[model samples]
Target: MDARVDDKVVLVTGASRGIGEAVAAEFLASGARGVVITSRKANNVEAAAERLGEPDRVLALAARSDSVDDAD
Candidate 1:
């Protein structure tokens, strides 16, 4: 659980809900400078970012996890 994430940017894919959302929240709790959360739908990711409660530190991205282009 020691992430060493202080002031670091973390990316969490499939983060619209469930474990992915939890992991992203953990990164935020661990003092990550920012969390970039990705989901296939913009609305879902945006909602998740809002629920995380740190607008300045969270970015919602719509992406297909299976897509290499999206990964880029």
Candidate 2:
């Protein structure tokens, strides 16, 4: 479990809950420098990040798979 992700960056989609959330947590635990999580519901993503105790490490953005660039 020595991934040593000290400066890794990960982008996770559909991360409000379920597998995506799990993956994000793992990345953080592995010492990732940053993680960006995207979901249709902005509030959910924000809440999840806050609960994880590193709100600044996560970027919660609204996105739709088909369209791309929902933040625009």
Candidate 3:
């Protein structure tokens, strides 16, 4: 597949697991320049980012998906 997201930035919620994680991975594979991943727990987000193995390209943030304040 082509790197459609080349040089683009992506934000992914609930990225600790499931479909969100998959989307994040796909974005990276498609050549995103940066990816921000969020989850309710800091530890889970950190772990997921670590597992993604692209420290310079990935950022992990803790935020509740149901809360608007957290999203800000």
Candidate 4:
């Protein structure tokens, strides 16, 4: 399937590790122009972004998925 996510900005929650991390990577591989990854811990979010190795394309934010304010 061709996702055609190229140049699209994607927001992924719980992206510090596991499936979330995998999904973020897949989006990058699929040619997404920007990927916003979120996790509860700020450090983890930054780490994940570094691991992705695309500072220009990846943005990391610390947020709780259940929190409405965090989503904003």
Q: Pick the candidate with the highest TM-score.
A: 1
lDDT by residue for model 4 (5-72), tens:
98899999999998998899999999999999999999998999999999999999998886568557
Residue 28 accuracy (lDDT) in model 4 = 93
lDDT, model 4: 0.92
Q: What lDDT would each prediction earn against the true structure? A: 0.94, 0.81, 0.91, 0.92
**What tens digits encode model 3's per-residue C-alpha lDDT throughout 1-72?**
455789999899999988988899899999999999999999999999998999999999998776568557
Looking at model 2, which ten-residue stretch has the lowest summed lDDT? 61-70
Predicted candidate 2 versus true structure: per-residue lDDT over 1-72, tens digit per residue: 467678878888888888988888888989899998888887888877876677778777877645657588
Show the lowest summed lDDT stretch of 10 residues, model 3: 63-72
TM-score of each: 0.89, 0.77, 0.84, 0.86
Per-candidate count of clashing residue pairs (backbone under 3 Å): 0, 0, 0, 0
Candidate 1 clash pair list: none
- Report each candidate's C-alpha RMSD, comma-separated, in the order given: 3.6, 4.3, 3.8, 3.8
Worst 10 residues of 4 by lDDT: 63-72
Question: Largest lDDT belongs to which candidate?
Answer: 1
Residue 5, model 4, lDDT? 95
Pairs that collide in candidate 4 are: none
Better of 2 and 4 by TM-score: 4
Per-residue CA lDDT of candidate 1, range 1-72, in tens? Answer: 697999899999999999999999999999999999999999999999999999999999999886567556
